[model samples]
Target chain A: MTDLNRRHVLGLAAAGLASTVFSPLSAFADEKELVIGGSIPLTGVFAFAGVAIEAGISDFVKITNEAGGVAGRKLRLAYEDTAYKVDQSVAVFNKLTTQNDIHLYYGDSTGFAKTINEELNRRGSILMAGASFGSELNNPEKYPFQFMAGPDYVEMIAILLEYIAKQQKGAKIVFVNSDTEFGRDPIEASVKRAKEMGLEVVGQIVTPPTAVDVSTEILKLRRANPDFTIFHGYVLAPLPEFLSQAKQLGLKSRFMGTFWSMDNSLWANVGAPADGYMGVMPYRYYYDTAPDAPILEKIRKLRPTYQATGYMQGFLTAMLMTEAAKRTLDAGKDLTAKNLKAALNTIKDFDTGGIIGVPISIPGNSVPVGRIYSYSAADKQMKPASDWISLKK
Target chain B: MRIATAKETYIADEGLLTTRTQRAWMIVLALVLVLAPFVLNAYWLYLACLVAINVASATGLNILTGYTGLVSLGQAAFMAVGAYAVAFLDGHLGTPFLLNIFAAGLVAAAVGVLVGVPSLRVKGLYLAIATIAASFILHFVFTNWVSVTGGMSGVNVAPARLFGIELASPFALYFVIVPITALMVLAAANLFRTRIGRAFIAIRDRDISAEVLGIPLLQYKLMSFALSSFYAGVAGGMWAYFFRVVTPESFPFATSIFFLAAVIVGGLGTILGPILGAAFMTLVPELLKYVVEWLGPVFPNAGAALSPVRTIVFGALIIFFLVFEPQGLAEIVRRIRRFFHLWPFKT
Candidate 1:
């Protein structure tokens, strides 16, 4: 052998390092295993929802495996943190898909869902669901391989509007939304729907997502002085400020919100100010003691604490994905996007063991179902105020 | 080892590759660029395409901030203009993608000229703030211009088609994006050899002195902005093709800061700086992912616990580079090349 020089050693070490890092880590994957890949936003702005979503998916995977995974195949979850960035999310997507035979995917944001939709169609293998309830992704013709766990943003707003219509005839309404894609998603559609329902829309207040002070917006809200104010797009923040300021102004308008802002624990922190605040919730609350909910009991036993609405969303998403896969396998078919999506649509009035409070069906890319819940300060919980409302009906 | 060489002509002295070794290395680099798509996997090809687009944009930012002494935070806005232009042309007119990209560059250049008018009055941080305001205005236009920009939903661009073949996959897009990036970088390198480029450098060194030398400040400043934003617009067109969708949220303010940071970290005012800086910045986060994965056995929830650490580490690395290698990665590369040139001999 030739003499071992320093340069040769360094070159060899670099080669070894590259090989170790780039080699396929999934080479040892079992044939009886199915992968559920995710681009999770475990860090950055959406970390709160991301953390809970990760846990919910992980817990579902574990529970399914323990009970013998769908069609004798074990379930595996491979995920990376995206920091809620579109490019980073795409990178995570490319990395995970390259390493695994993933048939199901979970995306973090609307931007991600849109960016990856073309790639999903090109692959023709993977079906996806995401944290985004953007109304744009609810089209079956455009996005055949993608679905959301519950109602799209517009449908959520529609559910709330229906509730308002039932409570009062031609109630004057105002919309307060963040100036974001998510916030603006339901506005135009909900406005039209509210008009169709004979409710008068008085004003629309748009605020920046990061606005700390809503003094000007409050002035606008005071001017409108509608019977009801519906807030969308934000998880927390300015809502509390809006609530407190609206109270100080002694405005008679009842405040409301949609899916992302309806969590009981979130409003509980706001105390009395959040009391009587209402919104549309697609899934049952964690502490929901309804007689039909076996899933809630299982969840409570697994973790003795209140899970966020995001957790319910994630859990329901996993359930729907698994059910689709199971139905595809049961029909002795390959898990191609077409077959799996067809199987998903076949889910008519499927029972969720109390997760959804009522049997849910998937007519298209969305469930289009929700119930209005009001937050009570004394109990610090979102008590159900309306029966389960399905837009499909 | 090369000791010294005497040049007989100015052309010889100013040559991009004066030494024989450099010419040989250039050939080798060409070969590697050609062979890379074949050898790299799908994920790496995706990253390569992304890096090429970033390099193009960062090179544009470097032209403005590093060479022309004009700080801008509107690179992303310019890119958005290009992306939207391409999206509209491709979606509405069904024109060829190359034509769409060229049109995108022109539109962005026009906007850049408008935005650059303030650079004549304010500079440094003030100029940067002005650019920031411009970006916010552009963002508002993109958000509210419902008829043209598709409002908040944004527009989806179809895959670039060449000879009826769709360039959808990373492997296919690699051919289109890489060559365009290479040509843009080459054009930037050649720019400094011209009178306009020299004027930019002169303005960067001292505007009053440059004015004394009879170089018109407004003309040169606007030209520099146009050229820089043209480069950015072309890159954004490539980005639109690569991502196949362009939303208002796609090119946020943070991305502008990202390109600026890349220029500083890659060694500003150098031909090779932006390329090195963009590649280094892009790969660092990806490398950290591997590092986190490697530590998984030792720490089960390392993904959650160390995920935030990756951001911290990224910040720390930037700081470390700023403090230690103030001139950036290009200087380090020069030192290594110089050491190799005079190997076995003490400098």
Candidate 2:
């Protein structure tokens, strides 16, 4: 060959060799592995929740692998940081759908979940189990591919409102929420339910997501002095501030929140003041009484950083995912997204043991309608307040 | 002696790939863009539509940052303005898609002019801060102005349609976004060859000199702001229409940073650079995702570590390009062609 031709051949060979060496994992990725992608916001504002969710997923994958995995094959979960940005989330979703054999997606936030639902509806390849309990996620008619790990936001709020109404006899409630979809859905639904139940909604205040000081809003609530305060918001850093401010304002009324406020860290920051805070969750984290509760113990043993409350709830979510995977395998079907969705729909009365008091199902448009858990500031524990309550569809 | 050789080489650097090649490439791009839907899958069409929108936004940003030497991180806010504008018009008046999009752009341009009023005095980091604050203020309005902007729940936008044909499909939207993007890019590219364009270049190099030459500095600055915001507004309209929804969460502060990063990494001050930058910023993370997916098993703790590493690598890559390849990939391609033409001669 001429020198130029020989040089071109050599360069091509070198490029090929480099790609093969650097991307050796790509070769093995094609072999018998079910890649389930988790699109979480690992970098941005919601990084804390994203980390907790991923930790739950990681621990679950580890447990499954140790127990011989699903259908005698190992399970892999990959995560991409959407940074809580829709464009970035869309990019991650595209990467998961186009490049990988990602049958399932998890950990997308509320807005992102809505966007992903629209995309998944377009190409019916991926089914999702996500951290978001937005009412949209539970709309089986709209998003057939999406299944929630917990009660819908509306259900959770209704349950909390109902619990408060029972406790206070005729409690005056105020709904304070960030103006995000995560905060608005529950308040909107619960307020209507509260009116229906003859519980007075004294005041409603909507604050911005980046409100560093919610003192004004707190003052408004304090002035109203509602018997119960339902904080339907995701205030990771500012939650403690809100609680402390409310305490300073001498609002002795009870404070409560949706699932995101169930974290111990939120309570730990405010101390004794956060004592009366209650949150509605799908499962009981500190429960030790059920027969099939070994998974809870196993999770605590493996992930020591995982406390009993939100971590266990997230772990139960992952456990539910594994059980659904097992059901898919039992049907002798390929672990495709469609088959997984089918398997999940067939998940009727899945008893999560003592971890969750009630048996949960996914087939219907209904949520499991979880119970209320009150946080004890002195003990730093979340305990179940009532039995699981089902609501009207 | 080396300087002499370099100076001598500059005369011979001109190649056959001039205006003809440029026009030829544009024609090829137009054809490929026209036929892209027929060849690529649904997902890719979606991605392409996004790319076109980014291209439109970046083109406007390129005019400000690349042509006029300004740094602003409020492009996303402009997009929000355009998107909300489209949503508002469509919801209230039942306006058609094309008219609404243009109206949205016009509104954004108006906002851009309002923001640029401070630019009459502010410069450098001060100007950047002003623009950054403008973005936050815009977000505040969107989040707090519930009656108009729908607060955080976001207004569900109506799809863009023409001649009774709904622009609902990704392919249909692609045709809408791509052609406008092409027109904007071509317009911007050709604009640089005009007096106002040269005036922009002059201002970019040294504002004092341009002002001395009577380029009407304030007028041109406001024009830059108006033009840049118009592009962002159009992109935002596309975003709302294509996604079939609009929420405050869709346009976060990070989006502005993403645009700035795309411009910087793609090749600041060049038309091709923003496109290259947008593609890099968009595609690199995607490529990293597959890489992480494939290598996820190698380390059981891969999920925990891969994302941070990708970000660190992204930062490092940007720095590397800025330091080692300041002219960007476009310049690198130019250098390679130069090298090939000058083959058989030693440096």
Candidate 3:
């Protein structure tokens, strides 16, 4: 406003941008707190999923504190929005991993994980998790410091293909997904597996996640006449519109999607058109109380606004990270990434109280299991259509 | 009110730092750029590095869009070319980072000429649309051209090595990035003093008049594009060194808008416009984060609302400047200087 104010703004611009690097060791000299940083896409196209994931993590932290914290130290998570951009996430990741001295971190996308992989390995002191269930970050050999909460997208696609193979012998399938690192992650394998299983891979529709018009995609599907259409790489909008449009056109393709597209809110929005929409979902739903998942009870109690599968993944991500931390400390080692990672690798058949399907394990940075679920128009829910499928030998 | 000192020679009058005050400011700015990495923490340094990179890219856009009157929406693509060039060279040849930076500019300049081909036939909004198409095509290339660009997974380069010292951290990168950016900005400012540069301004002011006066439109336009993309490429090379990774999404369409906004908000066609504009554009959202943090206690949902609110505020500020201060921050700064020079006399 004023010249002096302008000068002040310039000063702040030079000195105060991000303010991301803080020597956590210097701040928490008492060693009574364990800090974690996350770069979630809390305010972009993935805002809904981001917020839901935040709710899950927040509730998990709350429950951890209520249960007297991890290793008698308070667990805290500080995350910034990446807006699903790799650059923003990498910037945030650099800040958080470096001066923050955070024991753990969460990132936004597969791209961020890939970008930060070398840095994370070099640091090797901070464990990482986040939104992606794809990329080389899942390979512990590639990046030991990072891990996905579930099986990678390619594995999920394989599981879906396996399901389809069992359901029908010679089905024609078209893979429809958002054109992104996440969406395209499993496409190659999806096609190959379909061919390997003697299924006809008709056509692949790579549309933008925010595509409003499905007329072109519908026309393609109409031409190909696939018996099954599996969608991936989108959580919120495009699938619903496409599915509804396909139904309107009397296209008889059964729709399928991965975790992102397999959301209740997505199906709820699609309504009757999503009656038999299937998903290769990795985690149990927020309302899947038949299994009496304790994580759900904890989330329902702490964060009332939490819903959808992302929250469950978020909850699982936090719980898994903190559990490792708790185990590392209980193992009577210093609260370090090395110790926690050893604990993380040692995890096998560890119970999540069935809140997220059967007991899961992180053999090599990814939990290699997922379940297929179908949405019911009448019930307004996604019920498991197949039992748990695991990639682990 | 003021005394004008006549220059005895053309060189004295046409000098880059003609005034003692300008020389002093340059020294001070140099001191700040040099001393910044040591005093500031990594976060500030990281931001400073980003500002330097963005300022370089914005300066390139300013050359075309501001001085040449050619609106380009493909600056980010040009930058990507530069970045990937650096990444490819650094990854494969292990060439010296300095050579890589120049090669980046040269490669981007070649691509710039190709993209600027449309400028021969188009101008204004049509030109902008053509550039947008160019950018989309470039992005498509970055995505599907898996071998060179590393496909959708993106390419990673080791930390730039110079004398066995890796420019890995922001602290390490500051020394490399800042001087390069400063020199590039200097080269850009120096260009306006030359024939090609004057021709660019002529084309910008009125192309038909400039053509009648014997300036070739296509040649100068392509030169402007080449120069601008060269700057973008060098900046991109610096960015690759700073970030150490290059993805198709790294230089998204939003980035082109960011540079354009910087040139406009900094004062299009002016020397200091891109610098101030890039800094302002880069820092505003960060300042907004401070505002959101301050409001966190009162508004629980502030985190969820931060993005939209920041977007609104950013748009509002841009609109406010467009409506009220069309000449942008540079003009305001000039006015402030004039007011100070007048001191008590105006009152």
Candidate 4:
């Protein structure tokens, strides 16, 4: 009986100690502190995008801290590297939401966003903003917590197909993609979109994700002699190599890619060969003298060479989070995940301060349609191709 | 009578004891195993579950490499096969999770027989190379085959369920996995005592001599492969069900290396060695993570530095164990226990 009593006392002591440790920053505290989690690709295949997403969150935190923080308490941003691996990201997300008291999560990749959306919704985490422009993130009914900031890669492919049908006369389009999710996702959407747009998909080739020496595939492309070739790939290094090889092989194919393949680093890797290469971008480059905007200034401060793709992505996501937080505070709601999501839904016609040179807005459970921009190495800028084309419902 | 028999069996073995102190330690392990989930935080429970799965995998590898003297670098491929099989069956048939896991292992055992056919002709490094090739080829097929294997996009494994109860919760899931793993290990311990087990040891020691002794060396070696692959497959299925997702990247070439390293560092050719090795390898990282978290405030850039430092330290520990004590941590434990039991006894 004495031993039982002693064990009970010990258990109560442990519980008492836990309450003391957890109570200080508890949601029950007077001014609640919101915890935002980022499961980002800090290393691996898509490290570039991962680094950009994190910088964006850090800037958002800095801006919030400067502006008296969220509801007078600083927002705590906790990030874990997912390395662009899905299981690792899921594990990180589980840790953040289930174990730690984080309510908001920001994922880096399309796969990360899609995999964890259901889990986040089930757990009542409100806001999940990721740089992944996959259509899977846009469904309000399926994934309410997920709010994609920019145009998805599918929309970009559709826009690219539209341009190819109109601008390049008699151009037969051939899709060369890696044999992975990133490669296959756009292919499924674009094939249907291409049929709708009346562009001929001359050929389609699926290569390995880490494929080197694609001489065989390039030779196959040469035989197809398609004027427009869209290379849907993940790695930055290999796409340039593919381009250089294609040019040397005299394929005479005009190459473009999804957002990942559109970076200036491609041009730096293979200068003149990558001249006519173009891919769709959600926004203009940071150095573009497009218009007066606050985001441009922020971008410049973040990087000297504001032309880097990372700076632009970082600036855009940060702007979205900042706007969401401010609106939440204005609503007189605590900076909770639920309140933040409600604030995001209420946002409309907010400017990204000229960083994107395009006004950012969200209306009726959808990101405002993003305009397609094409990269030009001669001018070293991404000029607006056309106005924002609304995706068919 | 069983205890007496067990004591009598061990009495013939030198430098080993069946003392009261040893029995108490076993009882302590039993208590820890039962009470672990209650005391451990969710993070620890998750880590422990992973450790258990790794132990299961390492134990299987021990049967092939440790017991049968076959070095394999294709354990991950077998794991992938098992994972995909379970994933496919569960998605298609909605079979009970336990049945699906066993089915997956059985399917992998069939594949292991096919791979082991070549092992009859080859020996030593040649055998290792053949298995390593199997790992690479399987990894490639998993990555490229989109329709069946889900390609590189990966496959989502539905949460394991028994009857109507969801094993989605880590605690509930841990209970399910722990018992199954225990059963597998118990089965493995029983394996080494049988005629089939002795045939494996005989083949491992000298195939020609075993053949001369009228043991079907080919049949026994292939059976080792089948058993080893079956264990790996079951472990893989467990991993998939536990994580609720399986990607091609999840079972990589490096994972095969990890399994071999665990067995070598755990104590090859012994029953308890693989579990001991897996626990050490798996827990070391978790321990390092805890230490890093505790020391984060005091150390500059501790958060970023900790992961790389932990990885380096882990690698170093593996190398240290290999160089100094090739027999593994199991030997050290046995020694410590022996010293305590033999205290003040001159002989």
Candidate 5:
């Protein structure tokens, strides 16, 4: 052989780089597989929810396949860890969609959902649902291809408002939310709803998402001293301190939260301080053993530990997605976004196998149904405190 | 070995590509760019568009921090200004995409001049802190300015239309983004051949000395800032078009640090630095992602387990480059070119 010089090596490297970049990617999934793509935040700040959500989706897919699949076509999950960043989420969307014949997608955040809405409308192939309960996404006109598993943030707060209206007439309420899109999502709408329900809006306090020492916010809370304090847009932080300090000051205000912070395991970390803390949750808890909830029982048998509320949300989202797919295929129509979403809208009084305490209907983009659950320090669980309340009613 | 290149005239001597080989290589690059979209898959095209946007922003950062020696953590903020401007113009006025991008650059440049007023009084890390403060102020404005920015909910951007065809997909956008990035990079490379560019260099070396050499420090500094922010603004406009949404949280403070790190790691003060740096920075995470996927069969839950490790490896790679290759990947390129120039000769 001729001398293998550095020039030859360099030329070969350049050729390799070009070929790798330019090589066409073939479709990875066969026609029999209905791919469910996900931009899951398996890392970064949202990883706690992400891990559970991934497991939830995976378990649902496994269970569905074992039960004879959706309309005889196996469900395939193609996902990537986005680390909860919008750019990464978009990147994952592009990559997964390009590689697979995806008809359903699960987004991670409100930002990603919103950012990809235009693209979704343009593609008209995939229908999306996500962890976002942002009030803005509730509009089907703007986000036609997108839907959520539960009530939007506003409806979640409205459920709480309805409960409070029944429990105590004209209850003075204070809104404590973080300074974020997620935090501010339901404040304005919920405030209007609260007034409509004849509840008095006492004060609104906005704290930075990174606020570790909420001393000043607590001082504001003391001044408001409403009958009920509703916290939004936060998963865990500052609420524990807020509750502990409010208790220290002997404030009689009842602390409440929305879906995200309503998880029993999350509040259990605060122990006795989380006692009597209440929030609106759209789904049954992991340990919830109501006679109607066969799905929860099946979930418990699969994993013998307390699953976070995120797991339930993910499991239910997957269940709804596949149900839509099954409906579309059952109608003998193509699996286009329009067909899938149209089929989804046709769902009324649908059973979630007791994932929800009651039969639910997707009147629009959201389930618009939730029940108030109070955290008990003694049992370390969120016990149902109210009957299922639907926004349509 | 080949010894010397003879220049016949002053024009020939001052030319950017003094050798025929360089011009031929440039032609090859141009050909590659022209054919890229046709050959590459959608995922790669998407990445290419993203890399182009990042390259544009990183080049702007390189101009200020590398050429003018004024550090800024406000590049992302300037970009945000551009993105918001494009979104507003496109939404309200229904202006053409090109005009919206150009107007966005002008708006960001004006903001840059205001932010750079402190740079005259402060240099080095102090100047960096000032830019950081400016970034925070801009973020607050983006968040609170409900009428213009749509508050935290933000506004959706209409896809760019070129001659009545919507450039919505990454495949369509590749042509728009890549050519614009190439032109911007070219303009930046040509900037160093001008009087303003020389002034920037002199200021970078020593601001007092540059002043002694009859350069007005504040004017030149502000000019540099305007030019840099203009570049960043244009990049941000492109970003808005690509993503089709402009939220307040689009450009976080961490993004500024990313561009700064790109400039430093790519080889500070070099023309080729930002291009290579931005591409390297953008692609490395993607490469790491593939590596994790490859490890999936061997290691269980590798995607989840190695996700954090990918971030650590990214940080470590930057540190490694800073330690081992201070001049960056550009220097490596130069060394390889030199080795090729005298190949097969034991000099």
Candidate 6:
């Protein structure tokens, strides 16, 4: 303390801090290139899906640029990792939107999209597309510039319940979902819809999507002993835990799930118990053909690997945004968020090849369409349990 | 260049801002805070508001961990209590914004006392584990109490109204948040001047010795918990107003760790530590993003690598700070202050 030169240390510290002062001022937009930015959950609970989603958007941009840039302006996509935290997402949101003046923004989750809703409105300059399918996001009236690529959580629930009703009337059922916004997204509405369809819901269990041991939850479900159980708000862990335990306990009920849990990878985890498990998914699995699964084909050609629903959602979000942007320029309107959103509304009979069945159009910022598929232990694949279901209402 | 002699009275010497220099610095800082909103753009304003909310919460943690030496990892859970309290009451009663903040603090303080019950017997790592259990239980409640807590879908908080204007934007929230945070920080600093504050320090230094001195360990410990939780509650309420959404994910276990890290890195047992720590932790990610952005031209897949790199850098920085500058950023400030004050003197 006595011998060291304090002035030099202070000067060094000041110099170190000086670099930081200029950092917040970084990434001023390039006037010539069109910009799109996003916050992805690169390192947190959703990292597995986040990586795939990031690839989807980036690949689309790459392939599009190869063909020729959109509207003669090369599209530049910039993104930051949120680590699946809302605060970080909001920080990234502000930094990207304000500093880069990005024309379109992508978000990682339902919570982020909902939290940043007000800021998006106030800025009124960028269009927001997210990986979430929350029903709240379906309201174009409130969030005019916000859009999702698939059916809203509510619509997916309705579609599943309608399929369940078709299978057997007066069926006894159990509702099991993760205790997350994604899990709880369709419960109340599904309950009401079930009652309307004359299906008896025997039990409803809400556990964490990541819960590894669900014996207690299984015991609760066993008390109800319903004929069927539907799951929501999960991808891998808790679903397998719940399903495998239910199998060990010799529960005769058929298991089902929504889009998130319908991954092809999930079967490997649940193993033999996955034989009769069925669920709803908006996009066809990797094996589907004819309409050119453009994104999936590209992913396979380069990496030679399997794909999942997250990739589809990410690809379609970027696709729709690009389509909307293209339509704006095609109509000779300025390439602004306002014009892009308006042009997006008029997307009619858009043949998405075979990725999501043909002749698809966004109605109310959602696709509002899905199909029911059941896992076959013998064939090791998802067989169509029900035809394509559309809930225009 | 000597400007003053030693103080004759204890009161003058013990005041929160003891010297004329500190008072002047305070004035300058306040002026900057009030003026920053008008000058900073939307992004910086948003960042500033988030930092203020975090600082408010971090100050509370500093009281418990730094000063009192109880390592409770439920800061974010307490914040959830405060946040949900404000969200529910504001929706049902339509209470004034300030009142909601107070009520939020009180509710969080109540939960804090419950969480503190286990700390009576457990200390060190056990106490931390106990608090982690408490956090999980509270998370379960926040998610399952669907009728009241809105389950996992999370209930939305209506925009706060102040003088017939909505405090919806980050810029609009600055006025409501920054002043409250400042007052809370000042109040925390002032608490150390009282008997309660000394009792906390005594208990932290040696609970047995403090009990021998008739400090009433359990009562003071619980009181510290309540006080710390109250600060967290208020900050969470401000968070709700700023973010305009309340969900379980908003205040996860990671957030509690984030606050504890801030207190540790800012300089434990110092009033200025939490402030510095919270700001540094919050801004580091942004700075990392900028670092990655600088590399954008060099790397095509840098976007995919940004998150892992940020995480690595964050972990590395924390380790570096703990190993090398264990006294924290506050100590560095102290060194600078000492150097400036004793300049050109041969003491």
**Maximum-DockQ candidate:** 5
Report fnat, model 1.
0.60
The residue-by-residue lDDT of candidate 1 on B1-347, one tens digit each, is 77566789999999878888888999999998899898777878898999999999999988899999999999999999999999999999999989999999999999999999999999999999999999999999999898879999999999999888989999999999999999999999989998988999999999999999999999999999999999899999999999999989999999999999999999999989999999988988887887898798899877777888998999999999999999998998898788888887955
Question: Residue A145 CA error for candidate 4 (Å)?
Answer: 2.9
* lDDT digits (tens) for residues A1-393 of candidate 3: 656776688687656543432323244434787777888887767777888888778878878888888888988877766677776676666555544558888888877787777777776677888888884666777777888888788888888888998899989999988877777888987798789889999999899756888788899999999999988887756777777888888988898888787888778766887889898888888777664576676566665653977888888898888888888888898766678888998898889866657878787888878999999999988989999888744
* Local error of candidate 4 at residue B99 (angstroms): 1.6
Please give the distance, in angstroms, between residue A255's alpha carbon in candidate 3 and its true position after superposition. Answer: 0.9
Error of 1 at A81 (Å): 1.1
Clash number for every model? 0, 1, 1, 5, 0, 1
Interface RMSD (Å), each candidate?
A: 1.4, 4.8, 3.1, 4.2, 1.3, 1.9
The candidate with the higher DockQ, 4 or 6, is 6
Which residue pairs overlap in candidate 4's backbone?
A: A133-A152, A293-A353, A293-A354, A294-A353, A295-A353
Interface RMSD of 5: 1.3
**Candidate order, lDDT descending:** 1, 5, 6, 3, 2, 4
Local error of candidate 6 at B288, Å? 1.6
Best by TM-score: 1
Q: What is the TM-score of each candidate against the true structure?
A: 0.97, 0.83, 0.94, 0.86, 0.96, 0.90
Q: Would you list the rank order by DockQ, best first? A: 5, 1, 6, 3, 2, 4
Please tell me the TM-score of chain A for candidate 2.
0.86
Candidate 5 residue spans exceeding 4 A from truth: A1-20, B1-3, B8-10
Candidate 3, residues B94-122, lDDT tens digits: the string is 88989999999999999999999999999
Q: Quality of candidate 5's docking, in CAPRI categories? A: medium
Please state the error at residue B28 of candidate 5 in Å.
0.9
Provide the DockQ value for model 4. 0.19
Complex DockQ per candidate: 0.69, 0.34, 0.45, 0.19, 0.72, 0.60
Worst 10 residues of 5 chain B by lDDT: B338-347
Model 1 per-residue lDDT tens digits across residues A1-393: 999985699688678657844676557366798899999998889988998888888888989999999999999888999999999899999988888889999999999999999999989999999999999999999999999999999999899999999999999999999999988998998899999999999999999999999999999989998999999999998999999999999999999999999887788889999989999999999998889998889999998988888898888899999999999999999999999999999999899889897898898999988999999999888999999998954
Give me the runs in candidate 6 sitting further than 4 Å from their true place. Answer: A1-32, A168-170, A219-227, A249-251, A266-273, A291-299, A334-339, A376-386, B1-5, B17-28, B114-126, B133-137, B144-148, B339-347
Tell me the lDDT of model 4 at B97: 94
Docking class of 2: acceptable
Query: Candidate 4 has what TM-score?
Result: 0.86
Candidate 3 residue A326 C-alpha distance from true site, Å: 1.4
